[model samples]
Target: MSDTAPTAARTEAQTMLIAFDGSPEARRALTYAAEFLRPRRVEILTAWEPVHRQAARAVSMSGLRQADWSPSGEGEDPAYTEARETCREGVNLAESLGLQPRAHMVECATSIWSAIVDAAKELRVDLIVSGTRATSGFRGFWQTSTSENVIQNCGVPVFVVPPAEEEPDADC
Candidate 1:
């Protein structure tokens, strides 16, 4: 008899949530997922903080009166608009890579990581795909990476794509 072990049966099609922010690292994560996991459905999510909330924070920090600033009710917040565009870009990229993708924009109530985790839970995705900026040292310590937080808090599995390595110089 052969020495090879039997493989487990494959599960049904999986749904995946990708935290996208139109960064090169995010693109790499999407490419990795498409090449490796091959999930049946993908949700491209872009999270942004509302303009009013941001203005409020600025005012509070500067010790300015709340009445000094007011949100324009004319149209959608610029942050939300940018997030929607980013999500659309991600969906297009996913489609070009042969993935069935849907765009999702989330308003960040607390933090980007929190929004991503909440969206993943709401979507009931089998896996979360994210990319790391590869921050380290004092800066990294001060500013916690989103992927790190997601991995720690997300109940589901997470696939994180690290920043690409720099190419060696030809002259060297």
Candidate 2:
């Protein structure tokens, strides 16, 4: 055997919560995080909702009320099933990446940004990582730059991973 010195051990464990939605941008974040942070623990989070659950239930039960259109797709909405499946897909994607996460399914009650802030609070995480949707034109960029929810409300630092193809065009 040769006489060689070993590397020193790390004292602190850096941790960050990565919000996964099965987007390529999320995967890119994981890769970049592994390179940049080398975190000892990674918590992957996903947000879901039943947007107007209470309202829908009340509307159905009350004779004087009529059905209302909710973008988040609550009761009897065609998008509800798809949303549920998408959330499941997100969780599965996280698990497949070797991250044993604490799954949470919120009744489509609050905004996604708010939900993320709450999750970070509950987990006591130091950072929040998420992805922005693909944008092509001036209007799209404007929308991406003006988000004031989940990402902005969190007290901790937030890092958003943009799609590789959309990186040059994205504001984040």
Candidate 3:
């Protein structure tokens, strides 16, 4: 008989906050949480940084009249719209797992990491779950990983799920 040992399962978290951006890695993290921890309550928080030119200009420049800045025929900002859709998807995923989920789309004026940490604090979740992708080269060195930032800045516990590594074909 093989002497393989079974791994003990971790205790389920009471409340969990998932940082989702509708990416494939984020989806995997969600799946992992649903199958593993299965927290009592789940909340999906998407931090959206507005990239709209007019909005940024208004916020950046001083003494700029808000009434003078009119949208250049653009009805709604796409970035925010996508954020809302992502939150909805997270909610649907949670429902599929037999859990009621609350979705939050927070508009971040500065950085995404700050927004995530703030949400976790405001919500007072027991844990935070997010996914991270491996990066290389100079760009990777300069850019800070969101997961890493959350782990550092957030007071609550954080679970960062790395992307699944691709396996080479046996034929090779």
Candidate 4:
């Protein structure tokens, strides 16, 4: 078998928030999202850091705390750059999936989690979807994971695509 299960798992979407970060998992999620949001208007929320112009003003300039990290402050312009990459990737994938999608770059402070939540609130998304590992292993960001922080914070339904075991090499 192809090591991957049927992609017919995810349901259709009225409004979905595909969190794109240019990761493989995010890409895979892109595929699943395509299926779910096919031909539908999907919102691509890509989170980014803001320019930290004032961070240097702090005497200590210490590392940010969790809360501070979330809405703490904006980072460098590179934050939006990363978000842009995600949007670009999402646009390509969405078209491939036959989905009519619009992209929104969420430039915020701290991490993707915080940015996602902010976007959700601002956009008033009905649902959220993404690809994730089946379990929260050491590298299981796609699994029940930190990415799920969006679920915890956002008051929206999130559908996470369970990870599948890659098929063993046929060359073996």
**Local distance difference test scores for all models:** 0.88, 0.60, 0.81, 0.69
Question: Tens digit of lDDT per residue, candidate 2, span 31-130?
Answer: 6665565554567665554536646655776865766675543356544555556556665655666554444544435456776677789888877777
Which residues of candidate 4, in runs, are more than 4 Å off? Answer: 1-13, 36-39, 50-76, 133-144, 168-172
Task: At residue 10, give the lDDT of candidate 4.
Answer: 37
Per-residue accuracy of model 1 over 70-147 as CA lDDT, tens digit each? 677888888888888888989999999998898888888989999999999999887899999999999998788999
If scored against the real structure, what TM-score would every candidate get?
A: 0.84, 0.57, 0.77, 0.65
Tell me how far the alpha carbon of residue 91 in candidate 1 is from the true structure, in angstroms, after superposition: 0.2
Which 10 successive residues of model 3 have the least lDDT summed? 1-10
- Candidate 1 residue spans exceeding 4 A from truth: 1-12, 57-67, 168-172
Name the regions of candidate 2 deviating beyond 4 angstroms. 1-14, 51-100, 134-148, 166-172
Q: Can you tell me which runs of candidate 3 are displaced by over 4 Å?
A: 1-13, 53-74, 169-172
Candidate 3, residue 172: CA error in Å? 4.6
Q: In candidate 1, residue 6 scores what lDDT?
A: 27
Q: TM-score winner between 1 and 3, please give it.
A: 1
In candidate 3, which residue pairs get closer than 3 Å at backbone N, Cα or C atoms, i.e. clash? Answer: none
Worst 10 residues of 1 by lDDT: 3-12
Candidate order by decreasing TM-score: 1, 3, 4, 2
Instruction: Give a tens-digit lDDT track for model 3, residues 110-140.
Output: 7789999999889888799998886668878
Q: Pick the candidate with the highest lDDT.
A: 1
Highest-TM-score candidate: 1
| Residue 50 lDDT, candidate 3, scale 0-100 | 65
